[model samples]
Target chain A: MFEALGLMVFYENMLALNNVSLACGDNQIVGVFGANSAGKSTLMYTLSGIMEDIAKKELMAGGERITLRGSINYKGRDISHDKPSKRAKAGIILCPERRRIFPESSVLENLKIGGYLAKPAQAAETLEYVFKIFPPLTKIVRRLGGFLSGGEQQMLAIGRALMAQPKLLLLDEPLLGLSPAIQYWLAKSIKEIAEERGVAIIVAEQYARPIMPIIDYGYILENGSAVVEGDKDELMNNPDVKSAYFGA
Target chain B: MDILIYGVINSATLALMALGFTLVYGVSRLPNFAHGALYVLAGYICWLLLNRLGLPYILAIALALGLVAVVGGAMYQLILVRIRGMSISEIIASYAIGLAILEGLRWGGLKGGTFTLPAFLEGSVDIAGVSVDFQRILVVVLGALLVGLLYFFVNHTRLGLALKGMAQDERAALTLGIDSDRMAVASMALGSLSAAIAALILLPLGSIVVEAGYHVLIMAVAVCIVGGLGSWTGAILASFVIGFAQILTTAYLGAHFQVVVAILAIILTLILRPSGLFGKQKELEERV
Candidate 1:
């Protein structure tokens, strides 16, 4: 299991996340649900080693104690000191919110860059895999990223990340600003990515409606803290979650 | 007519250097004010090797270009890379380094006495019935070739397209796993290399001086701004416009005010077409 214990992250004067701890196994898809400004992104950032903080950290794969303080532990290895690029090479990739597609580049160039850390030949194969998942991208490989519609760009963004062949995919608000149809399309794609690739996922979203059913485990965040954490079904029906998210 | 041809030739060289400068800025989001120093230093280095070390012309030029690339790469790593988070300050600091380089070259050149290089190609060629220096033809041809190659590189090649992608969205580029640092270094080296080529061509135009790059530096800046900073074609067209202006001003207004006229033209362009003659609003990406 990959986990974080008693993690606290601060960005300057802002307490972005406080005392957060979570765990997920390779077979489980962990969903992070919170309202806007509930520190969902910060939690993901802290766990991904993109956030700096002061905390007593301990991460363990099975029984052995691993020091993951102010860092991320991937597969019993402390990847805290690794740069984001290196961490990415180690199969830990963040798709990030907003679907940050290099808008001036062609769609193919976007995918080519995703496989940049891997062997060039392997990267080409990965590019083909990415294209297979998003076939529309194959036709528009020459089209600039900026010219694509929002839905296309999001698909391209996720497709680009998939090119890395990540073991742990940290997706931050993949559905943000997307139309309902596109959102569902992406949600299905994410499920397919998880099941077909056997990639562990930590998807942070504002609501559980679209994502919770597919997740094996879940955490409910409120004001920079995880208030309710449990199995997806248990957390979905929890009273606090209903009151917070559904406003019931 | 000869002077006008010279202006056209010189402007082509300016456009060449400015194109590189603009590309570096577009991709790296840094002004690269050290570009002027790169131009002047390349000329000085080439002159040193050719005249002092007695090296062949092509060898000297190629060696100078290679040196600038190394120095440029090192400079970016040592200074710009560390301050990637500091955008405005980096631009200002690069200019400061450029000033320092200009001062050093001026001081060194004065102490060492006059510096000069024999024409690499030598003699004059008829361009549109005008008696043009062969080096002028070489400069134009080389400049066009470099621009064409650069266009292909950015438009067609893997690395060039990658760079263009980086220029579009740095964060997105990083997410794609493009090593932004490596791209930055390569862009800086190429920028310096472009300037180095300009220096090689410019050196034979006149005797070397410490402040020789100042005029060209200003021209580079003006051309970039007028060409629509990120547009390659824009830079080329703007270079010709400035080149013709320089020639006309030198003929009618005199040498003293040639630069002043050029500066005025830039100002006029800025006032009239802020996005540049070729600058479209769409090419600009969101960055602070």
Candidate 2:
């Protein structure tokens, strides 16, 4: 299980994420729905400890000042200050937005790279599992990552994340720029992955229609704040949540 | 006969010199201007071990290479890590380090062409009526072997694949538990080892002088620039292109025209194609 409390992130004077908190239990799929600039991706970055890296890089470059204040509890440990790689080694993997696959590497290489922390046996098993789950990837095993289509890239991204044998998978806008058909299909696959792998998943997205059915718990975020939190039925049936997030 | 035989030898030497520089730049995007200094340092260390300590030649070479790897890794971890992501600072800081090392040796009384590593073999052999020295032949053979081994390492091995991922998409690699700093350190060590190996093999052909340090830097820069910066295959091909051009110029125009050819290759590559031959990923995408 994972939990975060009093999570606040600021970029200089502007608040990017304001006291937003959420949690997910083991083998559970939690959804955070919001519009663009709603701090959804920021939350994902913070959870994965990439914000720490970005802030350090920015400070060195004399660029935007980033400040993050939060406590993330993963299992029984507090990992707020852990480096991204450390968090990854602890089995928290982020499938980042826009599918940042290794452009020059092949699909198989990308997956192999993702298994950086896994033992040889674990990596090999996960590699086969990935190709099985995302059957389309098997066809483009030798194709370059940059050459994949949006749907294919999304699959590879998730597949790559899975190669790390994640305990908690953080998916940031996996459905972005994809067709509705693939979005729903991917949403189904996400549920299947969580069920089969028994890994907790925190998926942040703008499209809630397909995502809402699979998420056991959901939080509606607006202007960097989580405005609503409830079970799937309670969130879907809320008049305000329906109007704002679902367009109903 | 001279052109063909010497061209291959010269090309292999260039490849060996540039491989470290290119590999470091490819993985960390850190243009280690200190590459030439490391090359010279390796040769100097081996010479000192052999002469001063009276160590065996093989052991001296191994120790020198190991020391060079440690120095290279320390260079990045101590200095380059701070200025990383700012390419300008990375260049200036690394160049300053390189300058200090190269000049430090000069100030320490390493001068002239008197210091030379003994060749591994005693004589030369004739191939197709052309007499080729054994040392020069070793450079070519080792160069080819190193290139092959490096290619295999980067693609097939776990660490190499991780480094490749870091080279292409660092944050993506980070989320997979491949630390950027660690990868950079590994690259610097490997790059430095390659530099040392080059110095060890090629220095036997002639004396190890301070000027050779600067010359190696120019050759490396020219090769990387002309080859299309981060592309491995491109660097090798560009090395051959520039290498043969240098040989052809030496044979016809004069020996001094060799460096001129390298500089001209850089300028021409920049003017004709701003990105080296394999610079643009979109162009490579067409092949996929």
Q: By DockQ, who's the top model here?
A: 2
Q: For all candidates listed, what's the TM-score of chain B alone?
A: 0.91, 0.97
TM-score of predicted model 1? 0.88
lDDT tens per residue, model 1, B97-210 = 888888987777533437776677889867778888887788888888888888888776667766887787665555555667889999999889888877777678777776
- Which residue pairs does candidate 2 place in steric collision? none
Q: What range of 10 consecutive residues in model 1 chain B has the weakest lDDT sum?
A: B279-288
Q: After aligning candidate 2 to the native by TM-score, how far in Å is the CA of A245 from where it should be?
A: 3.1
Whole-model Cα lDDT of every candidate shown, in order: 0.76, 0.92
Error of 1 at A156 (Å): 0.9
lDDT of 2 by residue, B1-288 (tens): 988999999999999999999999888888999999999999999999999999999999999999999999999999899888999988899889888999999999889988999999879999888899899999999999999999998999999998999988788888888999999999999999999999999999999888888999999999999988977888999999999998898888899898989999999999999789777645543221
Estimate TM-scores for all models: 0.88, 0.97
Give a tens-digit lDDT track for model 2, residues A41-86. Answer: 8999999999999999999999999999989999889999999999
Which CAPRI tier for candidate 1?
Answer: acceptable
Off by over 4 Å in 1: A47-69, A242-248, B1-8, B85-88, B110-113, B156-158, B278-288
- Could you tell me which 10 consecutive residues in candidate 2 chain B have the lowest summed lDDT? B279-288
lDDT of 1 by residue, A1-248 (tens): 57777766654446656777788798578999988888887676556554421121111112223223344567887666665566676777778677778765678877776666666787777787777777778889889877888778878888888877788888989888788877777788888889888899989998568887788899888887888898876986889887767678
Q: iRMSD (Å) of candidate 1? A: 7.7
